[model samples]
Every structure is written in structure tokens, then in C-alpha cells.
Target: MIKVIIIGSGNVAQHLIAAFQDSQNLGSEIELVQVFSRQTTNLSHLLDYDKITDDWNTLAEADLYIIAVSDDAIADVSSQLPFKNRLVVHTSGSVSLNALDDNNRKGVFYPLQTFSKNKAVDFKTIPICLESENATDFQLLDKVAKAISDKVSAINSEQRKALHVAAVFVNNFVNHLYEIGSEICQEHQVPFEILKPLIAETADKIMVLTPEEAQTGPAKRNDTATIEAHEAFLSNENYLTIYKTLTQSIQHNGKKL
Candidate 1:
């Protein structure tokens, strides 16, 4: 059996734990030996055969150690490990595999999806990015990744970093726009719930349509009158500035299409 151990107990840790529990590909062949974290409260909801610990010594018994801690803590947490034979991996997109010491075999198993502790995540649909120093390690990583997801890819460290940046652009920045939209709705006395359908449709259309093709708004239509009207409605200087900049960007980019 491939004895697996998980480090840290944050949002990503919950998702990883659920995936490891639901993994049918490995069946009984793989076992989740233990979970390590500073707090035992995070593991309270988890009720099964596995053990939880605040100590790092438990890592010595596992075959694979997965560091699911924050990006900044990854290197610090990894450097404290006492084992060498176990394959040590991190589930971070922004961090590099070399963050772990060269004394142990290292790899990355980054899941390309946002994880929230309160919001449930669909593990099977999320893409898993796998990378390792050698073919054998990569195969092992691939096996673990594929067991939880069908969308597994062999990405190098640089590509993974690039993807993480792109993800921030698409998910984080876009979500900020949604927050702004909600605030605008509040100020205008417009129902924020009314934007839900449009939001859902915007995401749905992208599944079968390119973002460029699906782009539609005053900017896309070059409706300067509507744009100016919206800008006039925005009392906030920053919002107006963003609206003008984005409109200009869209207009300039739209001409290429």
C-alpha cells in the first residue's frame, strides 16, 4: 500500500483529504497514514482510521508527505522534516519544487482550482498539475493525481508558475469586478440578485465560446453614449477611472477581432 501523509490543515487540506477519502482508483491499495498540522481542530471533522499530529516526527513513517501549507510556510515546514526516503510534495501553484531540500525526492501536485473551507469543491473535475525530478517520480505523481482527477497534466515548474499567475488574473481579478458590481448595485438601489443570472450565463457561455467571442457590452459595441452615462453614474473616482480604462482597453482590443 502507498502510505500517504498530509501536512497542514487549511482549505486545500480539506479538499485533498476528501479526495483521498473518495479515491476509488487506489481502492484499498493506498492508505492515508496521517495528517500533520499545528491545530488538531481542523482534523476534528475527519472521522476515519487516519491519525493527526502537531509533531513532525510522524512524517518518518509515511511513504509520501504532502505539504499543503501556505506558499510562504512551504519551505519552512519542509525543512523541518526528518525523513529522506519518502517522496515529499507540495500542493502549491506559486511555490517551486526546489523549495524543498535536495536531500529528499520532491515534486508538485498543484490543483488548478480555487478552494474555500466553507464552499465544497468538486475534486473529480479539477485539473491536477504534476511535476517531478525523474520519470519514476512523475509516474508516481501522475498515478496519485489521476486517481483524484481526470484532467491531470505533466507541467514543469515554470509553466505551473505561469498558470498560477493566469489563474489570479482570471479568478481573483474577475471576482473583484463582481464585488465592484455588487457595490454599484447597492449604491444604485439595484437588486444585486438580478446580476446572478448574468454572472452564471457569462461563465456558462465560456464553456462553448471563447471569451473574445462572448464579449458583449457597451465597450464591445463601441457605445460611447452608454459608457459615458455609466461613468457619470459612478461617483467614486477610482471606479470611473477603471471603467474608462477598461472601456478603452476593450475598444482597442475589439478592433483586432
Candidate 2:
């Protein structure tokens, strides 16, 4: 059995806990030995209270220690681990693998998916980006990743960093645009649900088609009148700047298509 301990109690950690629990049904030998949280109460709802602890010294011996803490806290948390020369990995996309303490074998087990505390995600669909300092450690992470997710890939640190940047643009920035659209709908007393089908269609289109091929908009078509109208309609200076910049990018990039 692959004994595992998860450190931290955030969205990724909670989701991982649930994923590992479900993995047992799939014939996985992974075991959830313990979970570390600064306040055990935070994770008591998701994990057995007995399996959760606040004291780092109380961490059980395990084959793998997965640190799912924030980017800034990963180094501090890994450095404080009592044991050394054990396989330890962090669940971060942007943070480098070297951030972990050298005393332990370091790896990155980044799940390329957005996590929400309330929302339930299917781990099978999420891509697990695995990286390790050595081939042996990579094999272990690959086994554990495949046990939970059908999509697993070995990505180097530089490639992972590039993927993280692209993810921020596609996921985080696009979500912010959705928020802006919602605000616009509220201002006009229009139901945002009206845009649901359009949103769904836009997302679905990219599944088979390249993003460039799927692109369609006033900017892409070089409809300066429509673009200008949109820029004029925005009251916020920040939104106007963003609108113009994106429009310019679309036009410039669309020329190649």
C-alpha cells in the first residue's frame, strides 16, 4: 500500500482527500494516513477528526507527503517537516519543485483544474501534472496520479510554469470577464441566465476546434464601429483599457488566421 499524508486543508487538499477516498473503489492501494491543518476544526467536516492534526510533530510516517498549501507557505511548511529523505510533493502549478526542503525528495503533483470548496469536481477529468527530481520518484507520483485521474502527464518545471501562466489567462482572466459580464447584466436589469447558452456554446466550440479557429467577435472581424461602440459604452476607465487592449490583440492575432 502507498501510505500517504496530506498537509494543508484548502480546496485542493479537500478535493484530494475526496479523490483518494474514492480511489479505493477503483482498486487503489493508497492510504490516507493523516491530514495536517493549523486548525483541525477547519478540516473536521471533510475528514475524520481523529485523522486530522495541527501539530506537525504528530505527522505519521508515510511514503508520500503532499503539501497542498498556498504558494507562499509551501517552503515554510516543507522546511518544517520533521522527517527527511521522504517523497514530498506540492500541489501547485506556479511554484517550482525546488521550493520544497532539500532534506526530502521533492516533486510536483499539480492538478490542472480550478478547485472550489463548495463545488465537487470529477478528478478523472482533471489532468494531473507530475514532476520529480528523479525517475524513481516520478514513477511513484505517476502511479498515484493514474490511480485517481485518467489524465496524467510528466511535465518539467519550465513547462509547468508556462502552463500555469496560460491557465491563469484562460481560467482566471476569463472568469474575471464573466464577472464583468454579470455586473453589466445587473446594471441593465437583465438576467445573466440569458448568457448561459452563449457561454456554454463558446466553451464547447473549443473542445474540437482550436481557440484561433473558434474565435469570433467584432474585434476578430475588424468591426471598428462595433468595437468603438463597446469601448464608449464602458463607464469604467480600467474596463475601457482592458477592452481596447484585448480588441487590439484579437485584431493583430486574427490577421494570421
lDDT of each: 0.86, 0.92
Tens-place lDDT digits, model 1, residues 1-257: 67788898898987888888788344845667788889878788973534788877654476678899999998888888886656899999989999987768999989999987788877989999998888988887777777788899999999998999999988998999999999999998999999999999999999999989899999999998899899889999988988998999999998876
Clashes of each: 0, 0
How many backbone clashes can be found in candidate 1? 0
Backbone clash pairs in model 2 (N, Cα, C under 3 Å; residues 3+ apart or in different chains), count: 0
Task: Please give the lDDT score at residue 208 for candidate 1.
Answer: 100
lDDT by residue (tens digit), candidate 2, 111-189:
9999987788999999999999999999989988988999999999999999999999999999999998898899899
RMSD of each: 1.7, 1.3
Candidate 2 lowest-lDDT run of ten:
39-48
Once model 2 is optimally superposed onto the true structure by TM-score, how far is the C-alpha of residue 225 displaced, in angstroms?
Answer: 2.2
Superposition TM-score, candidate 2 onto the true structure: 0.96
| Residue 119 CA displacement from its true place in model 1, Å | 1.4
Which ranges of candidate 1 are over 4 A from the true structure?
24-28, 48-50
Best candidate according to lDDT: 2
